[model samples]
Target: MISLTPLKMLVLLFSCVLSGALGGYYAASFSPVPAQIAIVDVQALVKKAVEKNQAQTEDDAKALMTKVKSSTEELIQRGVVILDAQSVLTAPEEAYVNIE
Candidate 1:
């Protein structure tokens, strides 16, 4: 077995520590970012759409629901937490975004 000098041992230890630190940094960089909280005024959106089209048919309602569902799903997939405007008593202005 080869005997390791003190200097050699120190260098090896330093390399190991450096590699571990770099690996951890890279891992952290690649990790997904935390989700953001967003507020959506579902009632307002529906109201606006309904107002635009005075004659609301069943098909139109179904289409609107489908659009909302798909949009919510997309936001959820991107790690966003959506809160209904009515449900949230208070939220930061920055948290509010147009879902349309």
Candidate 2:
């Protein structure tokens, strides 16, 4: 059987206590700070989305709407022709994604 001398036991106990205290000290020293910075404040930006529409004017919006309506009518006119000669491939031919 092995034995621990009293002095050796005292040294071992002290070493264990010292190791725990240092580990706790290091953990506290390296812990993260609780704060962050936002690049943009959305509430303020939404309030500024239109100081008065410049590039995208009321007339421009109307023109785009008319273009969309015309394109939609053309698609409806040729709906069956498009429905035939179909395959899994559509737009983005390399990637196959299920619309549903």
Candidate 3:
């Protein structure tokens, strides 16, 4: 059976812990990484935003088309509200009827 004396074992353990701590400190203090920096192209982003706005303006064209359709429906509903006062004519007393 082989055995190390108690005092020699303690000294070896202390030296190993001390060297490991010093190596970690030296590595952290002298790292060679570059610092962070940033740059942005403000004008190009603004131009892209203007283009997006121009594309979005086409929504107004669709809104106007819908408005025209809604107004046509309102006119048809108003025509239905008017009643026939005179009847027994060729078609109606006042309503315009196509003869053909």
By lDDT, the best candidate is 1
- Alpha carbon lDDT of each predicted model: 0.83, 0.47, 0.49
Candidate 3 Cα errors over 4 Å, as ranges: 1-3, 33-44, 54-100
> How well is each residue in 1-100 modelled by candidate 3, as lDDT tens digits?
7687999899999999999999998998898743221122233433555576766455655654454445445445644332222332333223432111
- Total clashing pairs in model 3: 0
> Can you rank all candidates by lDDT, best first?
1, 3, 2
In model 3, what lDDT does residue 36 have? 25
Better of 1 and 3 by lDDT: 1
Question: Root-mean-square deviation of each candidate, in angstroms?
Answer: 6.1, 21.3, 31.8
Score residue 80 of candidate 1 by CA lDDT. 88
Worst 10 residues of 1 by lDDT: 33-42
lDDT tens per residue, model 2, 60-82: 55654455445445444644122
- Write out the backbone clash pairs for model 3: none
- What is residue 45's positional error in candidate 1, in angstroms? 0.7
Q: Which ten residues in a row have the lowest lDDT in candidate 2?
A: 35-44
Candidate 1: stretches off by over 4 Å: 1-35
